[model samples]
Target: MTVSITDVARAAGVSTSTVSRALRGRPGVSDEVRAQIATVAAQLGYTASRSASSLASGRTFTIGVIAPYIGRWFFGTVLDAAEKVFSAAGYDVLLYNLGTPETRKRFFTRLPVRKRVDAVLSLLIPDEEEAAALRSLEVPLASTVGGAREGFTVVGIDDHAGAASAVRHLVNLGHRRIGMISGASEPLHWTTPLARRRAYLDVLADAGIEHDPKLEADGGYTVEGGEQAMTELLAASRPPTAVFAQSDEMAMGALRALRRHRLRVPDDVSVVGFDDHELAEVIGLTTVAQPVTGQGAEAARLLLEQLDAPDAEPPGHVQMPIRLILRETTAPPSPRGPQ
Candidate 1:
């Protein structure tokens, strides 16, 4: 026979209402009584039905996680870390993948999450329309890898600082003619690409180097895109002595492109990338490392805090740190290169 709440209540010598409050971790139950009730429930193998619990508490105990692309290493890592936290807290995760503009439009128009989840964690920076739609849902929301908005909490690394750090590393290595491989300029709502590109320009200006638009190419933040962009940069009349890719994946592609052209890393061309991906160590990619997984966990925690106390003060922004990791991919510019 399946054990029920009544059995737990009888065993703990407490009323059903008291047992319910204790199990839900709500107030109005003494500590001793709550402990006794919990012990009795566990011993009796009693498990509350989630459906019933939701009906009573008006909480689904589910979190909706939205990401632009789940296949990407950063997004996958964040989702995995966030899942662990929510699962341990007796909450389920519902994933929504918005990989294309069409899918994003459908998701926002449908607004399928209504009454299905207690909170939301968005991995992408929403545009104005997307932001308005999210607010229409009236659910507690938080974001990772995005900028802070008026009503939503955000957890992310300093994109501008990360980009500046990459450029600084190249400049310090005596590289005057530097190039950049960045994400495509489309999807203007995504702030990371814009922030990083702006920082790269500012850093170059600060180093007394005139910015050359010809030395920059959009790599689309992919290995293939990086390869194509690197090819274009190398074809320039006066190519850069070093290149900074916005992502390690792009950097890896840049490495491939250089090899194809019979160029040696740190010899013919020094390279740097952002986000210390797992393969960075194996390939010796110099990059700016950020806490990708930790950001996800933090986003989950913030959402849960809001769920626990719906009337609490508005959530604030959280900015994580990033550091440059020295590796073999970067060195002083070769003397033979153009000064």
Candidate 2:
């Protein structure tokens, strides 16, 4: 027979109401009685019902966390950080990895998150129709994808400025023939990749360097993709003297490709990347550092704020700063490179 909250209360010689308050960590139960109830519950192997708790408090005590992908470093790190925050606040997290079209369709159509989670946090920006559907749920929503979304509480870094700084660093090192390792294109409403890509183009244009269509290769935001893209760049008629990879993972792959081709970094090609990933310093990669963990944590906190007080005003936005970290990977190009 499964032990229940009633068994715990009976064993502790307390009312069911007292047991509920004590086990749930709610107020009104004294420290001494709470300890006895806890001890009894453990000994009896009793567990409280989430449904009962929800009925009493009118809250699911759960937060829905949605992301485009989970295996990637950025997504995993953010989700882990957010989960920590939610766990500490007595809330469970329901993860949704809508990486494929089919999964996304199922999510929106089936509404798995409907009436299940008290609030939602999106790690990737949704399209207008999807956003409208989310809003229809009438729950507090937050995101850490793009900067300052209108209807959602947002926490993100300025992608355009961060990418610009990375490209400008290469330019300052006297590199005109700069190749770009870009990420795959995103959905129409997701502007993070576009913002970063636009920054690269804008910075080059500002420096009076004519755009070379062949200089940019899509990295697909993966190591293998980055290596392949780098190989393509190396085969260009006039290879770049320096390269800027949109992500550290891509930059790492670029480094590998250059090594395979027997080209010395900084001497043959200076390189820069975004996202100061954990292994970046280990490999001495120069990158633009954004607070990935902090961004997720803040997004969770913002959702918590709304959950705590339904009528409370939303926290408009939290735009975290980024830092350009200079490392051994970046330097002035060799004299043999294109002018």
Candidate 3:
């Protein structure tokens, strides 16, 4: 015979409601109580019926993830991590890729994610209109790789601190003529990579280095865009001695450009990248390693917390740590470098 909540509660010496909350992994029950309830429920062959529970609680136990570009390595890595955690907790995930401006507008204004999931998770997504749409949903919301505003929970690296560390590393390595490849254009809310650029500029100014507009190029967060930007910077009369690409893929593209122009890395032009993607280690590229996978898991946890208590606490910012990985990609400039 299947064990019902009544049987589990009787065995665990708790109320039926407590047994239900403990089995569902919801708050209000202590970890010890939850463990005891689970042990008894397992011994009695108790299993939850999600459909019936949804009918009783009016919650789908699902989360909606909104990503601007799901194919990118950074976003993909984080999404995989989130999926693992949510699935393990018996929650479903719905992904929405807003690739075009029109689609983004529709998603925010018309077809906002509603009634489908109990909460929402956004990956490095930035837009005031979109934020407003999420606010209107009345569902718990969280973001990864960016800060939370207006009560939306967030889990991400401190971009300003991380960018400062990256630049300081290059400066300590005796590099003064440094350039940067910034992310795509966004004038509203500050995106992670965009904040990185600002941090770079602020650090350069503090170090008494000139911020050359010519050397700072826009990569548009694509390999081809990085290639084009590197090409333009290299063709300049006075090129930078070191370059910082916003993402690993962009740095890889810049590497290709350097090779085509007979510019040897660390000898002619040193390079650094962000995200510390898998290719970074393969190519021996120095970069800052953000906890992409861990960030995803933590974001899911935060969203679940909000779902349990919509009025528990206003969402706050969370900063995961970052580390600077030194590799063969960056070195001091040669006496006679590419000129």
Candidate 1 Cα outliers beyond 4 Å, as residue runs: 13-40, 186-188
Query: What lDDT does the true structure give each of the candidates?
Result: 0.90, 0.89, 0.83
Candidate 3 residue-wise lDDT at 224: 82
TM-score-sorted candidate list, best first: 1, 3, 2
The number of clashing residue pairs in each candidate reads: 0, 0, 0
Candidate 1, residue 136: the lDDT equals 83
lDDT comparing candidate 1 with the true structure:
0.90
Q: What's the lDDT for candidate 2?
A: 0.89
Residues 225-303, model 3: lDDT tens digits: 7888899889778898889888778888899999999989988888888888877898999998888899999999888
Q: What is candidate 1's CA lDDT for residue 125?
A: 83
**lDDT ranking from best candidate downward:** 1, 2, 3
- Residue 153 of model 3: what lDDT? 81
Candidate 1 Cα deviation (angstroms), residue 38: 4.7
Error of 1 at 86 (Å): 1.4
